[model samples]
Every structure is written in C-alpha cells, then in structure tokens.
Target: MKQYSRVTNGYTVVDDVTTRPMVRGHNFPAYSFAANFKYLYLIFATDTPRYDYATGYLSTEGKILRGLKPAR
Candidate 1:
C-alpha cells in the first residue's frame, strides 16, 4: 500500500506499507539458499502433512520477505 500527502509547496510525499524484521536474531531456515544481485529463493520445510513444502523470497537486504506456494 502507498500513501501520498499534498503540501502547500506543490509537492507530494509518498509512503508505502512495508514490513521489517520482527524478532532481533539471525534467521533464514537454512544456510544454503539461492540468491542473486537482488533476490533470493529458498525452500521452507512446512513440516505439515497437507502443505508439505513452501517457497519464500527475500530481498538482498533481507528486509522484504514473503511466502508462497511452489509452482507445480
């Protein structure tokens, strides 16, 4: 989500809804994940009989992370 504000100076200020790290500790389920200049792809063992496995993406800075189902 993005938010904008108007000021008398004829300029608009913009802000976006984003999430940062929650717990202050070293994370990333495993050590050997795939990465490049911008993003990373990793598998998270869901450990659930139904889900089985899942996918995750993280920015290089590890700030923007999200989860999704792997493509069949």
Candidate 2:
C-alpha cells in the first residue's frame, strides 16, 4: 500500500502518528487538512463548491491495523 506521513516536527504535531498531518499544499489538488484517529480525516481541495471537495476516513486499531475506504 502507498502510505503517507510527515516528520515529527511542527507547531500542530500530535504525539500520535495518525493524528499528525500527512501532507500539505497551496492550491487545487493540494492537501490542506489531515487527521489521525481511530478515524482519519483527509480532505482534498478541489477549489469548488461541490460538497467541499473529496474526503476519506480510515478507521484503524491502535498501533496495528484496521479498515479503509476510498475518497469520493
């Protein structure tokens, strides 16, 4: 699987791996927001008024693995 993550250094970094940001950018096709939890919140910026862009949430167990779904 193709995974994504960032180095553990920043102003809004959380101790948990999943809660920290996965990526970032400036314009369309940019990753503006990400979250790590039992459920992950990944929002892609399409720069339009259509349902506020595509999103994905991954539900996982602690330090192991769980489930996933694709963005729409």
Candidate 3:
C-alpha cells in the first residue's frame, strides 16, 4: 500500500490492494472473502480577484473529489 500528497498542486494520490493467504494443506474447500477496502483522492484550487474593491464581493468556487468503495 502507498499514499502520497502534493501540496504544490493541491492533489492527493493513493494506491492499495487486498490479499488473502492461501489455506495451507487444505484441499476440501477453497474460498476467500472480501475484507473491506476503500480509497479516496482530492484536489483543490483557488483564485484571487484582480481588483482590490472585489475583496468584499461574494464569490463562488468549485472543487472536485474522487471516492471508491470496496467490492461487494
């Protein structure tokens, strides 16, 4: 598993995996169940107005984020 964040670009990255050890000396039945895993990433950006008078002006901004859920 690995995780990293870049402040300069306001972006985040994550990598991960889930695995189960094979049953030892067992052949009657073989199966594996999900252990529940999730991942998320986010990025942000901002801009400033060019005019000083716009400082008090109301502004709207937007953001984007990604989310992942474990397989059922």
Candidate 4:
C-alpha cells in the first residue's frame, strides 16, 4: 500500500488508506454481539460504520481541498 500527505490552509492532511477497518457495516453477527444490544435501536438508529474520515463537510483528495472554511 502507498501513503500520502499534504498541508492545506495550515492543516496537515493524509490519505484514508493509512488505517484499516476493524468493524464492518454489514456485519450482522458483530452487531448481535455488542454488549448493548437493542434490536429496534440497532435497526432504526445506528450510525453507519465509519471506515474513513470523509464527512462530506470538505474534500481532501486533490492539490487543494474543496469546501474549506474562510479564514477570519
């Protein structure tokens, strides 16, 4: 695997591939095994498992980041 990094607007950014997924979104057995198992809550209110840092608030994959906040 490869790695990358850059500085943007004073923030250091890196690739999401630097990490591994410990838990998967579609893992039913794992969800069944959580200590706080609540069936309705799990089905209706669970957050999608996060495998990366992308939150749609900004983009960090190019020469410059998109959707950056303006400096005051």
Best by lDDT: 1
TM-score of 1: 0.17
Q: Over all chains combined, what TM-score does candidate 2 have?
A: 0.15
Q: Give me the runs in candidate 2 sitting further than 4 Å from their true place.
A: 1-3, 8-23, 26-35, 40-72
Clash pairs, candidate 4, are none
* Candidate 4 similarity to native, TM-score: 0.14
In model 1, state the lDDT of residue 12: 32
Give residue 46's lDDT in candidate 2 (0 to 100). Answer: 38
Q: How would you order the candidates by lDDT, starting with the best? A: 1, 2, 4, 3
Residue 22, candidate 2: Cα error in Å is: 9.3
- Report the lDDT tens digits of candidate 2 across residue range 33-71: 422332232234235453222343232331322243454
lDDT against the true structure, each candidate: 0.34, 0.33, 0.24, 0.32
TM-score, each model?
Answer: 0.17, 0.15, 0.16, 0.14
Which model, 2 or 4, shows the larger lDDT?
Answer: 2
In model 3, residue pairs whose N, Cα or C atoms come closer than 3 Å (at least 3 residues apart or on different chains), thus clashing, are: none
Tens digits of per-residue lDDT for model 1, 2-71: 1223244332323332434222222332322323222322234335353322344455554335475556
Task: Give candidate 1's error at residue 20 in angstroms.
Answer: 38
Which 10-residue span in candidate 4 carries the lowest summed lDDT? 1-10
Better of 1 and 2 by TM-score: 1
lDDT of 1 at 50: 33
Which candidate leads in TM-score? Answer: 1
Model 4 misplaced stretches (Cα beyond 4 Å): 1-37, 48-72
